[model samples]
Target chain A: MTYLIEGRDGPWELVVGLEVHAQVISQSKLFSGASASYGGEPNTHVSLVDAGFPGMLPVINRECVAQAVRTGLGLKARVNLESRFDRKNYFYADLPTGYQISQFTHPIIGEGAIEIELADGSTRMIGITRLHLEQDAGKSMHDQDPARSFIDLNRAGVALMEIVSEPDIRTPEEAGAYLRKLRMILRYLGTCDGNMEEGSMRADVNVSVRKAGEPFRTRCEIKNVNSIRYVMQAIEVEAVRQVEIWEGGGSVDQETRLFDPARSETRSLRSKEDAHDYRYFPDPDLLPLVIEEAWVQDLAAHLPELPDAKCQRFQDEYGIPRYDAGVLVAEQATADFYETVARGRDPRLAANWVIGDFFAALNRTGRTIQDSPISADALGGMLDLITDGTINGKIAKDVFEEMLESGESAAEIVERKGLRQVTDTGAIDAAVQAVLDKNPDKLAEYRSGKDKLFGFFVGQVMKAMAGKGNPALVNEALKKVL
Target chain B: MSLDPATVRRIARLARIGIDESDLPALQRELNGILGWIEQLNEVDIDNVEPMVGTGHAALRMREDVVTDGDAREAVLSNAPDTAGPYYTVPKVVE
Candidate 1:
């Protein structure tokens, strides 16, 4: 990680924070009846409220509030029984209303902590300052034509959970980990899909540099980084740039900047505004949000096991290594798939096949675990065959390739392909005798204590049986003859 | 805070406004008035009150681990400004 603007004369450290915008998973928009589904017609989801037509007042969506509470609980934060919506006054071509309805003084979710894992398998806790809900602004397009600025209102009035974090992160890796852990928790709590690429989730990274133990320095907010790789790069570039500025007897200004993916650099957009600059005032039309303690308690009770807890549980129950469990449980789909295969079969074996051979097949076919050619039950069947000695471990590969090629059950493919492991002792003995009779020189090598030649004899037996001979049976028959 | 000419100019630049130096004093007064009104919130006893992000109080909804996407390129690029046969088009570079 190098400085974007480097001229070193003094020391500086980066003080980073994040304001993550996550879309609420709901059927409708924040204030309107329009559908909140993505990939719809450009503006087909727009409503009168979203368009900011005259005399439109916002009505609180109960589902959206509940989602916020669930998120607060998942983050181990305090849930406010009383919260208010304020008007953050601003003017933009995309914002239909001159002011945006957001939370300023009273955010719904309060202080919390997220445990982020570093690259070296160490963990650190990042502080979550607050989580507030607000309406998303429309997108303004400037590249379409020279004179026209097109505004897409579909996003306007959509609900967003702006999770603000404390300036506790130091390195770019910590920021990336914080984002990943936060996304995992959100998805586990069923609050957000955490799909950054879909514009459903985004982060505004604030980075600055100061002396390591000095009070926090002025920082710049990098707006709307939509991917983990870009977020990390933005922090590194911004931190080094601040360091160089301070080292050069200059000052770091608090401003808003945007990261350019093409050049891998951040550019200034404007000076970052403080809360006072937004001129936030309680909304005159809507009243304070008030939820009963009993309802919030119920939501907390029904919360699913979060990522950290589930990862540990998977390791304990499945007898798999922690790293393997971590990989599987990091994604709910992969975890569920592993559980399906591990239900009755040997848990360790199931994990090995899923993570090893199964993942390889998925990678080869350019498909995800969810789209793999072998279903959990089909793979489970293959494992059962291995455990029952119906097919040896070596033969399972053949069955796996056949399953991918023919899309048939492992057992059916094994039967049709005659891949059954040959366990007949008399047949194996006769095959070994015939091979040994013809290859007398090889037999003499085995008798002379050249035991490595035994593998050659076993290979000949498997070939005599056209590669279907049970390896265990072949080993036993070769031992008897020797 | 007195609205210094330079500070006012900086604010104007941030808000994407073009303001003459002479009008800085008046604009500063107007902004202060608004900020003063907002200052009223500081008096509210909200030290223990929980901040609410949105109006709805429903829990987050989640779907099963499923992939509901197929990356339909035509469907996504249908709304782009300029596309060249399944790809977004941009200005020529290195000309």
Candidate 2:
């Protein structure tokens, strides 16, 4: 569906692009041997190279580079065998170095695409322009003091992969979906942790509004939106503001803006005149990064199965619906859990149980799959009792609840509670006959064209048998008597 | 390839250098002379030549991902003009 904003002139289309700064997961910083862990004592992770001591030079960390390569491969982007780092000169208290070493003219990864599925079950391919490596500045905490901002250098010189996207997102939902899919891919690749709350991943959103079939207008960039929801909301309010400006006969100016999430509006950070002029030039301290084809191939070969491929395989191999497969593969741990339960068993049944009750139980208890009270093996064992006619479905549910509460296996719970299914025809006939004798009026009504009363008979028969009677056998006995 | 006065002022402002109005003329002359000397490369006919990046032909060297340094907060912040606890302090630059 086309997303349009009805304007006084006509309908306006919102154009969006995102630049995501994903902190690379590694043991050390990009250039120094400082620990790259998230939280620490202030300035404890700062090395001389990170702190910009005079005559100190930066040496690249091999694992950071490999992490970037793995991420590029995950995105299906082109890995530039030879890439150079340039110094972007600026002055900031957070940046001890006067210049930040970043990939400017030549990025390490080029042109890739991510496929995002919308709520309507429709998919769109968002184009990725480039992915570059850069150093993150130290964090400045302005709330710590009345007159000065305290700087923590723990995050300084951390490796960040700035993934830039093309202006192909037409709606706010697409932006959210694109971010979610990108985060999922990064998490699967083990390149970035994708923890927005921890400040590991951040996005700068560019939004523009133009009438349909018209050329692009001046775009405003919203910097450092921490959450996906905020990114969507910022794009929406910014686009509406732009449309009002255009319709009111005022031209929009290109600038950088900050998203005030509390106010749900974007305010200008700087205008075009005061725009940053980062004097970029090649860094003399480091040589060009060059990798071999063999190394790239090895990384590609060892990559874990990505979400899309795993989703497709789940559908094909397990005979589950596409929606179920998509839900299962949203998280790697959940997908692994589903696979363990589905193996050598009724896959569709396993999927139904996992997607239905197991997920609901986890949500109710506020637990993740990693710490789920019921293991995959235990759930599969419960399914085994149902498949082998050891217990009826109704009894299985009670057993499942008991297993969850008491942490007992399904078979043990069933044997101890005497909740096994009564598959014997003799017992089922006796129960059905007793229900019929007690409900003679209802049976007469059921025989007299009240076909819906048949359900009532089945209910009563199962109730008489304490809900352990096999449903199919009860229905069979009830039909034979009628 | 020449440096105009306005361009010089803009460059100085971007570099956060305070330049005097009286010094603009001489600074422009010196900057233009430097650019003029480097502009000789534009006269050479080398259309297909690849830009040389660094002096050495060797690729960039990388070290293993190990926490071999850091944890000396005092040493790291020794040269700071102002300090707060273990943090380096500067005038509030909230954005």
Candidate 3:
């Protein structure tokens, strides 16, 4: 469904496209041998080329290039064998080179698409315009001192893959979904960490509004929205702001604006005069980036099974519901954990335990799949006990709780607690006879066709056995006796 | 394309070049002359031809991923216009 915001005139639909800057995960920076790790001492990761020394030249890092290709393949985009880097000439305190090396006319990754699953379980394809590699600017801290600004060149010359998207997003929800899906893909490929909080990944949101059927109007770029929630809020707020401008008989100027998350508003960062004529030209130092066709195929072949394929396989192979499959495949680790527990076990039961009590326990303890107290193998072991009738379902819950507390194996816990189910029919028959003797009036009524009393007799029998009686065996014994 | 004095002045400002107002006319003429000479290439019919971005067909050479350089804080900061405690200091920036 198309999301619309009601205005004085009518409902207006928003058009959004996002440019996400994901820092490529590599050991070194793009053109230098400085550490690419985050939170280093200021300027500690700087090389002569990164710090823009006189006559210093840049050398591309091969692993960074491979990372970009891996990301492109994960997005299902076409990778160009040959792409050129250009110099975007500009000046800032942080940009010591007076120009940024970026891809302007040609990029490594061409047109592609990502499937974003919406909250309604409906999927939509968002077009990816291109992905280009670029160098990052250094950090300029304004508040480090009262009278002097501080410059940290650690982030300078870091490889950044700027993924641009076509304006296919019509709602903030779609935008958020697209970002999340993109982040998940990048993380799965291990190309980028997708850490928006640490500034590894960020989006510049472009938003415009018009009547439902009208053509796209001018868009205002919301710069450097760090979080997905802020991106969504910025789009809605900016779209409403645009609608007001259009209705008020004032033209919206095309320019960059900053999303003030605190105020929930966007303010102009620069007017037309501040618009840059980057004077982009091919970089003279670096040659055109080219890769062998076989290299791309190799990268594609080695890619881990992505989320969509894993989700579909889970439903088809395990007979799990679509919702359960989606939940399991949201993270690679969770999916792997589920597979370990589900293999050679009752899949539906495994799904129930993992998605139900297991997830609840993790949430209650503020732990993730990696740090969960209940290991996959341990859960599988518990399932094995349930299958073999060593314990009943109710007793298994107690065993699971004990396992959570003591980090012991399910068998060990069951043994220590002596919570084994009584599967012997001879013993179960005596327990059933004792229950019937105690509940004489209920048994009489049950024989008189008061079928509701059957449950009362079964509960009494299980309780008489200290909840150790196999439910199925107890049921059988009671039926035969009655 | 022809360059006018105003356009030249704007370009100079954008490039952060300090050009005297009196030099605008001369700079405009020189810039236009260069552009006119470059415009001569438009006379050639190059249809179906790939635009060449560089002179060489060599692919970009890549270096191994390793942190072999840096940690020369004193050397790296040697050329800084102003420095304080391994940091490059500038006049207070408001934004």
TM-score for chain A in each prediction? 0.92, 0.98, 0.94
Comparing only chain B with the true structure, the TM-scores of all models are: 0.55, 0.85, 0.80
Model 3 C-alpha lDDT per residue in residues A1-482, reported as the tens digit of each score = 78888888888888999999999999999999989988888888899998889899999999999999999998889999999899999878788899999999989999999998888889999999999999999999898788888898989999999999999999999999999999989988999999999999999999998887898899889899999999999998999999999988898888899999899999988757857688899999988998999988998899999998998999999999999999998888999999999999999999999998899889988999999999999999999999988999989988988888899999999898899998899999998888888878888899899998889888998888889999988998888989
**Which of the numbered candidates is closest to the native, going by highest lDDT?**
2
Rank list by DockQ: 2, 3, 1
Which candidate ranks first by DockQ, i.e. highest?
2
Candidate 3, residue B5: lDDT:
85
TM-score of 3: 0.93
* Residue pairs with backbone atoms closer than 3 Å in model 2 (clashes): none
TM-score of 1: 0.82
Q: If both were scored by TM-score, which would come out higher, candidate 1 or candidate 3?
A: 3
Tens-digit lDDT track for model 3 on B3-78? Answer: 8788998899878899998898899999999999999999999999997656756788889999888777777788
Clashing pairs in 3: none
Query: Which portions of model 1 miss their true places by more than 4 Å?
Result: A1-14, A271-276, A434-460, B1-95
Per-residue CA lDDT of candidate 1, range A337-403, in tens? Answer: 9999999889999989888999889989998876887898888988999999989887898888888
Worst 10 residues of 2 chain A by lDDT: A270-279
Strongest candidate by TM-score: 2
DockQ of predicted candidate 3: 0.70
What's the residue-level lDDT of A357 in candidate 3? 84
* DockQ for each numbered candidate: 0.07, 0.81, 0.70
